[model samples]
Target chain A: MKKKLTQFTAYFIIWLLLTWSLHFQEVMVGIVVALIATALTRDLFPDEMIKFLNPVRLLWAIFYILYLIFYIILANFDVAYRVLNPSLPIAPGIVKVKTGLKSELAKTFLANSITLTPGTLTVEVVEDNYYIHWIYISTEDPKRQKQIIIDRFEWILRRIFE
Target chain B: MSNPVAIFLITVGVIFDLLGCLGLIRLPDVYNRLQAATKSVTLGTCMILFGTFLEFGFTSGGIKALICLIFVLLTSPTAAHALARGSHISGFKLWEGSKMDKLEEDKGK
Candidate 1:
């Protein structure tokens, strides 16, 4: 029941954000739409939906977004420099890095973060191991690779999702 | 719109879009091309939408532009990840200059 309410609130908030209107008719329609949508997707959400309400986690999530955008811009310039360089200097490779996070949601966030930041793309995830494609193979050691890729985002993600 | 910031952002976005296309053409292999193109084009498109938001303010069109930006940010990397995994699973080869293939190594064991 609480999960249903949480989902309803989420959908209603999205509806409000999308419409940005306060008319009685609009609000009524928005509520109905959110209800139907929530009912339809009731069982799809993880059981820990209520954890999203924690203020500290919410703060960390906002921080994560700002952190992600900063890295993304930095990453773009780094890639742009390589792409424009005369030699096309890339030492591309697929490397495996392990994550200690147990939650699927956190893993997804980590993978998405990896894809946008620096010169890395997460090609696959097998259990706790992520197979990432690196644009530059800076080090061959697995621990250093994990430090560079997963560690940057994993700790914050644990706070938010785990 | 007469907003110079908006115009400037749109101009930078176009340059990034152009670079992304160039990377698609110039890069040696599928994974390399995916990396370069996805990063550049996704950011380029987001910048363009954000510029539109700045130009239009809080109107419906502007709000929609923000929504589109969020959707692009959420989905583009996911789509690219899917493509990279699909191609690798189906046996696409990395460029010869690539330094390692740990995914392949895992497959061997």
Candidate 2:
């Protein structure tokens, strides 16, 4: 019951953000739509997702977005430079990096961050390990690879989700 | 529409998009190409949407552009990851110049 209410609230808030109207009719309609949507998708909402409602977590999430955007811009410039270089200097490899994040959501977020930032593309996740297709394999040491890739975002995600 | 900052951002976005496509052709293997293309293209599209938001501040169109930006940011990497995993599992070999294959090695264990 609590989960359903949370889901409904989320849906309704999204509806409000989309419509951005305070009219009573729109509000009533959004409630109805959100209730129906929540009823249909009650089982889809994971229990852990409720952590997102915490204001601290929300603030951390916003900060994480800013952090992510910074890395994304850096990633774009790095790729652009490589693409424009005549020799096309790349040391492509599939390297493994381990994540300390326990929750599925956090792991997914970490993997997505790795894919968007730097020259790494996450190919697969096995247990706690992520198989990353690295455009530039900076070092052969596995510990260093994990440091370069996962450490940057894991602590922040820990704060947001864990 | 007449906003200079918006115009500048949109122009930069288009240039990045062009470079991403060029990467698609020039990179040796599927993974390398995916790396280059997805990174630049996602950033490009987001920048273009952000420019739209700046051009039409707080209006319905601007809000929609912002929402679209968020959706693109969330989905593009997921799609790229899925494609990379699918291609690798389907026996698409990495390029000859590749250094290591930890995924294949893991399979042997």
Candidate 3:
């Protein structure tokens, strides 16, 4: 019951933000939709919404998003440079790297981040190991590759999710 | 829009989108092309949506643009991963100059 309420509240807030209207009719409609949606997807949410609702975790998550945006911009420039260079410098290959993030959500977040970043696309995730297709095959050592890929984002995500 | 910042952002977004298209044409293989399309196009579309948000402020259109931005951020990489995995599973070979195929090795193990 509590989980359903939390889910409804979250959905309602998103609806309010998207609608951005204070009209009573709209608010009522949003409440109805949120309730129905929450009822349908109750099992979809993890049991503990408390972790996500923590103010400190929320703040860290925001900062991590901003940092991710900065990294993405840098990645775009790097990809653009490599693509346009006359030499077409690239060493494309798949390399395996490991992540310590235990939760499924955290692992998904890491994989998505890897794929979004330039020069690295996560081709597969087998257990804790991710097979990433890197545009530049800088090193064959898995530990070094883990440092290159997972280390940058994993620490911050660990705090947010774990 | 008359907003200079919005116009500039849209311009940069278009340029990045073009560069991604160029990469699709020039890159050697399916994997490389997927990288270009996923990274560049996602960033480009996000920028364009952000520009729209800035131009419209907190109005309905602006909020919709923000929603679209979030949708793009969440879905593009998933699509790319599916494509990459599908290609690899179907035994599509990497370019001749490629270095490793850890998946093949893992399968053999």
Candidate 2 clash figure, as a count: 0
Model 3 residue runs over 4 Å out of place are none
TM-score of chain B of each: 0.97, 0.97, 0.97
Candidate 3 chain A lDDT trough over 10 residues, lowest sum? A42-51
Instruction: Name the weakest run of 10 consecutive residues (lDDT summed) in model 1 chain A.
Output: A42-51
Each candidate: RMSD: 1.4, 1.4, 1.4
So what's the TM-score on candidate 2? 0.95
Superposed by TM-score, candidate 2 places the C-alpha of residue B91 at a distance from the truth, in angstroms, of 0.8
Which model scores highest in lDDT? 2
Collision pairs in model 2? none
On the 0 to 100 scale, the lDDT of residue A28 in model 1 is 100
Ranking by lDDT: 2, 1, 3
Pairs that collide in candidate 1 are none
> Candidate 1's C-alpha lDDT?
0.92
List chain A TM-scores, every candidate, in order.
0.95, 0.92, 0.93
Off by over 4 Å in 2: none
